[model samples]
Target chain A: MRVLGIDPGLTRCGLGVVDGALGRRLSFVTAGAVRTSSDWELSERLLGIERGVQSWLDEYCPDAVAVERVFAQHNVSTVMGTAQASAVAITCAARGGLPVASYTPSEVKAAVTGSGRAEKQQVQAMVARLLALEAAPKPADAADAAALAMCHIWRGGAQDRIARAQQEFHRKAGTARRARGV
Target chain B: MRVLGIDPGLTRCGLGVVDGALGRRLSFVTAGAVRTSSDWELSERLLGIERGVQSWLDEYCPDAVAVERVFAQHNVSTVMGTAQASAVAITCAARGGLPVASYTPSEVKAAVTGSGRAEKQQVQAMVARLLALEAAPKPADAADAAALAMCHIWRGGAQDRIARAQQEFHRKAGTARRARGV
Candidate 1:
């Protein structure tokens, strides 16, 4: 499955797409940052982000979108902007009828580096290693976004598989009951 | 000028339109809440808000939009939703090229009730009095939305006039200087 991960911020929104399925080799598709001007008004900046996310979705066309869930407790000043940006990204994906998922920063770090308290550099290095890239994705935002996508593939993908398996099992059981006229 | 006010929330986004200008008799255009189902997904709820705000803008055709500025410092549990909803509303207005303004909750309360620390009922009471309505706008969110529009008409409206005046003064001064051949 192809997943697009978003590390949302007003000043710089990270967009990354990774292609993989559960227990499959992951490959990098694309990674970039949509940077908005600091001097622009709040609405204009948000509009820029909205358009940027739209363009990213148009170009990459990922199966699902994963965003980093924002918390109000941390980063008192930037949390609002981050929340706003994430809203734009998630809303855009949803408008396109794609499933949207969000993982906390710790959840992403733990998934990527096996440590919720992993350092940024450690996560970056692991991302590079996981994707078999010569270098970590440039700019921390893009790397974080890539990590989010990977996390979703590992966690959400497993859930998807389990759900499909349950449906198949139920279908088989129903067929067996019909054959026995029960 | 006609102004649309939004008290943005994920579950129930308030939308209100008020007609008036600086120092003019403010009248209510319309007020309502865009209620979304809690059972809906986050992105689905946001999409519902987007469509609701768009329909309001389409029908009301307001000259500008006023939204309550969300702060991360307050309502930790609900602030994220508020911020996301505000972003959706502000972005919708911006996309339509309508001027968007935000006022803090205190600003709205103070502008409507003469005190920033005024109670909700007090603000609601003053909103009814200011609009000359027989009753306050039903649903606290809608009432708050109206108050936001009133606040913009009082404060942002003045700033807008000053800006227009400055531009007019500049134009006249330029003409005078040209005519004087200085």
Candidate 2:
């Protein structure tokens, strides 16, 4: 399965696409960033991001999309902008009929470097080695996006299956209880 | 001029439209809420909001759009969701080529009730009286939206003119300074 991962931001949004499935070797397809000027109006910046990401989705046509989940930051404006960007990505993916998943920064690090506390350099290095690239992707945001894509390829499918199974189990259990009328 | 006001939320987004220009008596156009199910996926919920807001823009074609600016909340998820919805509203307005403005809750209250610390009932009562309606709009969200539209009608035009004048002044000053070879 192919997956597209996005590190959503207002000024700089990173995107990476990977081709792979569970228990299979992953290959990098593309990695890049969409940048918007701070001088522009907020709506203009958002529209720029929307157009850029939409173009990427149209080009890559990934089976699924993964985005960095935004959490609280010390700066309220920064966090709000990040969340807004993240939402745009999610909406775009849904519009394209692609399943969307979100991973925290630590989750991406853990999946790529086997340590949730891994440093940025460690995560970048591992992403390079895992993808068999001679060098890490330039710019931390690009490398982070590549790592996120890799993490989703490695973890998302299995996690989704497990969740489906759990849901089915619960549904069956409820039906059985209702049949027994207890 | 007509203004569309949005009270952004994940589950229930309130939208209000009003017809008026600065220094003119305002008249109510419409007020309603866009709701999404919590049972839906995050992307689905966001998509619903996007479609709903976009349809409103298409139908109303307001001169400008106003959204309630979100503030930090004790619940991270709730705040993030709100910010996301706000972004969607802004995006729709921008896509429609309508200038967008945001106001804080206190600002809306102050504009409608003459007090930033006014209670919800006071704001609703004031909005009903100002709109010449027999009853306040149903649901606090709808009333808040109407109040926000009224606020923008009363405040946004003057604010925009002042901002434009300031920009023009700075531009002229820069040109004069450049002519002096400074």
CA deviation > 4 Å runs, candidate 1:
B180-182
Cα DockQ of the candidate 2 complex: 0.57
Candidate 2 lDDT over residue span A53-86, tens digit each? 9999999899999999888864776898898888
Tens digit per residue, CA lDDT, model 1, B1-182: 88999999999998888999887899898898999988999999999999999999999999999999898778899999999999999999999999999999999998998899999889989999999998888888999999999999989889999999999999999999999996
Instruction: Please report, as a residue range, the 10-residue window in candidate 1 chain A with the lowest summed lDDT.
Output: A69-78
Query: Comparing to the true complex, what docking class would candidate 2 get?
Result: medium
CA deviation > 4 Å runs, candidate 2: A73-75, A160-182, B73-75, B161-182
Candidate 1 clash pair list: none
Decoy 1 TM-score against native: 0.96
Q: Write the per-residue lDDT of candidate 2 for residues B64-110, one digit (tens) a residue.
A: 99899888764776898898998888888887888998899999999
Which of the numbered candidates is closest to the native, going by highest lDDT? Answer: 1
Instruction: Compose the digit string of candidate 1's lDDT tens values, residues A1-182.
Output: 99999999999999889999988999998898999998999999999999999999999889999999998888889999999999988889998999999999999999999999999999999999999999888788999999999999999999899999999999999999999999
